[model samples]
Target: MIPAAPLASGRTADVYALDGDRVLRRYRSGGDVRAEAEVMRHLYAEGYPVPRVHHADGPDLVLERVTGPTLVEALVGGDVGVRSAARLLVDLHARLHALPTVRATDPAIRILHLDLHPENVVLAPAGPVVIDWANAREGPSALDRAMTALILAEVAVDRSLPLSAAAHELLMAYVAEAGPLESVAAAARLRADLGAPDAARLPDAVRLVLAAGAPGDRAGAGNLALPDP
Candidate 1:
């Protein structure tokens, strides 16, 4: 057992270091570890820059140790770093979304990094290596984008980590490059609706989306409340 301190914890998983050369991931036993593992494998096979899976035994998984600072830590430096991180995100999303619709339709398919905030991306020698696929699932890309945008906005509000400009640019670039504006718009709305009155509703909405078979328009329905630009 790696006697490493817990690096991070989420609703479904926990991450720890393994002697500074690898990371150990333990999922909540009852959750969708199989699905997550499949998605990780698919993404890796598709050439997306992801941490290499080293071992898997039931709920525990080990992956290659990616070195360097996380995008969130890099963002704290200033606007330039934030903008660079945003650009990397847009690029990564574009590449992932560009995979053939047929391949993307695999039952195991899911949004890559459904929780794509700055913190989930690590800046590596090769580029940005996305981490934390706990929330990943077969879903619309817009939901991923919206989730990332919302998290960035919240960080700005609570932590004074400014990424508004970068976030706006990233959205615009995504729209211009390959994203469906309507879906993005809908996700923005959904975030607003779930965030108000009951902030806890956001996670529920995300779960609902994943359960509904990755439909494209679900994020737009219901009352949507976009954060201030």
Candidate 2:
């Protein structure tokens, strides 16, 4: 199909609206588009809230067009609150991790959405649906949650995405849901090496969360505060 004007663009792909109900995601980088499509298909089949994959061709993927504000947009527009954002963040992972791992080319561990956050979450009419699967991998659930926390921190301390409160609240909620952290430092280091846009800010954010201790503990939820830049 002849490409029309793109509706949105991101670091890894460009989004083009197609026949109203669908959209085309054309990659801007050399990453494995097919792998991304595969991952989406996997999660979709398992009843997870991922955009339905219509087709995938090399760097181009056709996906169901979901309508609704992203959690970040909702927060910015005052359509949602910090407390709601926190719940959404925690709930997104809980729902994702709850699904049984059907397959994996690697260790066959849990499917990890290494980039889950408000920006990628769409509060669709049915509920919240996750988008962007380029950074997904099959790995430990904690590592996945850790990656999300790092991104949240990056938003607050690094990129300053304007939804810093959402990020801050999510981190504490994550701590509450994730229980105790084992190797958050290792997870932060791992994500930093991947060169995400906010990788530079991860160390500081991770340190702050660790310093706050686990949520519900003395320095966590009981004394919860947004660790900002």
Candidate 3:
């Protein structure tokens, strides 16, 4: 049964409490959720901190109701530190990248959460559980890491957003521990295609990402612009 109101909402979907233990996440524009559900199920089987899926049909996915503040919420409330958040993100990426792909011909291909930013992570009682698999795909781990870095970099440079300064510090710390960001340009291109509202900030985002990376690897990236999608 559908609830009277959504428990939460996001760019592409809204989550409604179905019961005490479960929630239904429905996309605004209806579409099949089998692929997304399959990925989440695979991740859960691999012991990742994704919500347990009970069912998926059309645009609706029923999943375990995870309770806690999001990573962004925790950080904004001073419940977590920038360095700590950076480390946690790195750890989550490492764990996710370690898992094998659900189905891929290439061995290097692993499950990639194209959107792994703080707002998409729930700091549950058990641990941090990642949500929103809409952008999930099988790809090189570097691309996934690059996506996250680019997302943070966007916020770091956007003065309109709250916690912009902390975002910069978080970006610096995250990039330091994030290893070679060789796929940042690719990530930027993919992000550009998503039609994000802050598309104008992408040029600045690319520059910030380059600056945050180690000296030599930043070449050919400092002046990068969002390729037309």
lDDT of each: 0.59, 0.74, 0.87
Q: Cα deviation of 152 in candidate 3 (Å)?
A: 0.7
Summarize candidate 1's per-residue lDDT along 12-75 as a digit string, tens digits: 6778888677888887654436666666777788788778887777788788888878775775
List the candidates ranked by TM-score, beginning with the highest.
3, 2, 1
The C-alpha stretches of model 2 lying farther than 4 A from their native spots are: 104-108, 159-161, 214-229
Clashes (N, CA, C under 3 Å) per candidate? 7, 0, 0
Model 1 vs. true fold: TM: 0.67
Q: By TM-score, is 1 or 3 better? A: 3
Worst 10 residues of 1 by lDDT: 205-214
Task: Judging by lDDT against the true structure, name the best candidate.
Answer: 3
The ten-residue window of minimal lDDT in model 3 covers: 214-223
Scored by TM-score, the top model is: 3
Clashing pairs in 3: none
Candidate 2, position 45, lDDT: 95
lDDT of 2 by residue, 152-180 (tens): 77766644466666567667766666566
